[model samples]
Target: MTAVQRLRSAAVLSPPLLWTVVFMFVPYSILLVYSFWKTQYPIFVPAFQLGNYMELVRDPQYLRVLLRTLKIAGLVSFFALVLAYPYAYFLVFKVKRPSVRLTLYMAVVAPLWVSYLLRAYTWKTILGTQGVLNSFLVSTGILSEPSSIFLYNQAAMVLTLTYVFIPFMVMPIYAALEKIPPSLKEASADLGENRLATFLKVTLPLSMTGIVAGFTMTFCLAFGDFIAPFLVGGPDGVMIANVIASQFGAALNWPLGSALAVVMLVIVLGIISASDRFERLGAGRLT
Candidate 1:
């Protein structure tokens, strides 16, 4: 390429490249450096060490919390996929009217207009002992009084995360389903394949890209979430993020917090890598 072409390319990339360096790369680099340092009470000592990471490995409580965090994240992703896929399929295949499809899509995305904190707190209210569900059950004689069964548990955390992230799953799957050519199904039928066979072979394979995208997105978000757990995930329901928050907050242990953050980033990146492979495989099948 010509020097002018190179110059033009550099100019076009400069803004985003500078922004990433200043905001993302620099901050992450600082965190990475901090993760190897020691914290002396409120002061951060500049000495390089592996004590923070070593502590993470040595502490059974930290390992348990990490496991619980992964479990909750996996459950949230699975439930979100289960709930979102069918709705997306219905919107793409069953709904005939474009206007109705648009309306339904809007409804699915409408919750994003509200603040996430507000939504999390709203679930807290709905699941509380004296909340709407309990009140309804009591009034209908399903129970003699309001029950504490609904709130402050892993189940409550799962429910709230699933509700919050369902739309993330829905939109991607819908986009993939919408892109599928109607003629492909017709061709399969003309070739003497049954609907179920055609769907399993063609429809599902094509939609895997979106499924992988949605699942990865939801998993990462739910894994990093601290708010839902903080609001409704009582003693038994707390995840690793809560512990990480405490390390950075009241504990004032920056090194430990940075190490934990790095570990989470590594896991999230690994998941994304696997998802990318799945996406590539799906694309290859389509081609």
Candidate 2:
């Protein structure tokens, strides 16, 4: 490449690289420093300490919360994947008009543009005692009284998060399914295989990449979600993020929160690594 071309390339890349170093790397470094700082009687002091990490190691509450967060994340991922597959298939294979397909896809993803707080709040209102759902049920004689069934519970949190995050799951799977050539399915049918069998042997195997991608995306979002749980989840529905938020905000223990944050980061990275390895293994088997 010419010097002018190299200069152009460097100019294009420099802004983003500089932004990442300033915004992401610098904040992370500060967070690491904060993680080791000691909390004084009324304020956090400059003294370094390992007590925060040691406390995390000894606390069963943190362990339980971490486990619960994982469970909820697993459930969210599972539900999102299972639900997204059919919708993705429809959009890719069943939808005929290109314009219509684009419109439908946008509809599925439009929720992302809405405020996250508003979405959670909407669910909270829908599930609340005097909310529209309860009013409708009572008027229709489905229930004589407004039951405390939905508001501020694990189920509510899961439902809200799943709804909020389904688009992430759908996009990847849709891309995967859409990339699959139609001739492959025709060939499978020509070989006397039924539709289900063809999908199982051909389409499904090829779509593994999207499944892995969707699962990773959903798990990461759900795992780090605090607002959903905070708004709709009562005490029992609290996740690791909520605990982390409390440590930083109400508890005023930045060190403990930072330690927990580090732990969460490790867990997310571990899951991603395992998923990538599994995806590679699956690809190897197919070949």
Candidate 3:
């Protein structure tokens, strides 16, 4: 390439490359280094050690928390997929009016405009003993008094996460569903395939890309979230993220926190990698 052309290309890429290195790579590298160090009360001893990771493996509490986090994340992803797929299909296939579709899409995405903290707290209020739901149930004579069963539990955590992340799942699936040509479905029908068979074979397979994307996104976000759990998770809802937050906060164990963070990052990356592989395989099969 000519010098001028090379200079122009470099100019185009430099800003993003620099931004990534400065913001993303550098912070991650520092966290990795911190993970290997030891914390002595208020002081961080800059010495390499695997003690943090060892403790993570040996401690049953840590393992349980990690497992719990994974389970909740998986559940959130599954539920999101179940709820989002049909809505997306309805938007793409059933909604005939362009203005109506656009309005519906905006409605689905509208929750994102509100603060996440506000949303979490809203759920907390709804699930509380004296909350609207409990009051409604009591007033209906379904219950003699308000119940404490709804708030501060794993169910609450899962419900909140699913509600919050549903839009993420919906948008991707909608995009994928919209991209599917109507001609393909018509062709399938012409070939003597029923609507159900055509959808199962063609529509569903084609939308797997969006499903995978949504699942990965929701799983990672849910797994790493500490705020929702703190708000509504109560004792049973506590996940690895809560533990990690404790290590960084009142625990003041920076090295341990960094180690936990690193481990979580590794797990998330592993999931993404597996999902990418599965996506590739599905795409190949479809083609």
Candidate 4:
């Protein structure tokens, strides 16, 4: 390329590169630095130390919380996929009218237009001691009184997070399903394969990219979530994010908090990398 072309390219790229360096790179670098600092009494001192990260390694409680976070994230992703895929498939295949398909799709995703906090709060209200479910059950004589079983547990967190994150799963799968050509299914039918066989051999494999993407999105979101745990996941439902929040806020342990945040970032990046591989694999199968 000529100097002028190079200059033009650099100029176009400069804004985004500069923005990333300033905003994303700088903040993360600062967080990295803090992860190595030492906490002295009420304040932290600048020093190179692995004590914070080491504490995380040596701590069983942190491990347990991390494990719980993983379990919850996995469960949310699994349930979201289970729930979202069928609806997405129905919308793409079963629904004949374009207008009706759009309406149904919009209805499934309409919850996203509302505030996330409000959505989470709505679940909390529904599951609370005097919440709608309990009230209905009691009034209908299904139960003698309101039950506290619905709120403040890992199950509650899973339910709330699944509901909150289902749309993420739906959209990607829907897009993937929509991209599939009907001719492939026709060819499968011509070969005397049943519908289930065609789906297993063709549709499911082609949609793996979307499934991976949706799973990664929901899992990461659930992994880093704190609010749902705060609202519904009572004492037993404490997650890594909640622990990280306490370290930074109430505990005033910036070093530990930064280390935890860095770990979370690494794990999320690893998931994205795996999803990229799956997406490529899925796309390659079409050839």
Candidate 4, residue 270: the lDDT equals: 93
lDDT by residue (tens digit), candidate 4, 225-249: 9999888888898889989899999
- Tell me the TM-score of each prediction against the true structure: 0.97, 0.92, 0.97, 0.97
Candidate 4 lDDT score at position 181? 95
**What Cα-based lDDT does every candidate model obtain?**
0.92, 0.89, 0.91, 0.92
lDDT of 1 at 238: 76
Candidate 1 clashes between residue pairs 3 or more apart in a chain or in different chains: none
Each prediction's RMSD to truth: 1.3, 2.1, 1.3, 1.3
* lDDT score for candidate 4 against the true structure: 0.92
Output the better candidate (1/2) by TM-score.
1
Cα lDDT for residue 90, candidate 3: 92
Sort by lDDT, best first.
1, 4, 3, 2
* Count of clashing pairs, candidate 2: 0
Candidate 1 residues 237-262, lDDT tens each?
87878888998888889899999999
Select the stronger candidate by lDDT from 3 and 4: 4
- Encode model 2's per-residue lDDT on 103-199: one tens digit a residue: 9999989999998888889988898999888998999999999978978888888889999999999998999889888998899899899999988
lDDT digits (tens) for residues 181-203 of candidate 3 = 88989999999999999999889
At residue 25, give the lDDT of candidate 3: 97
**Candidate 1 — number of clashing residue pairs?**
0
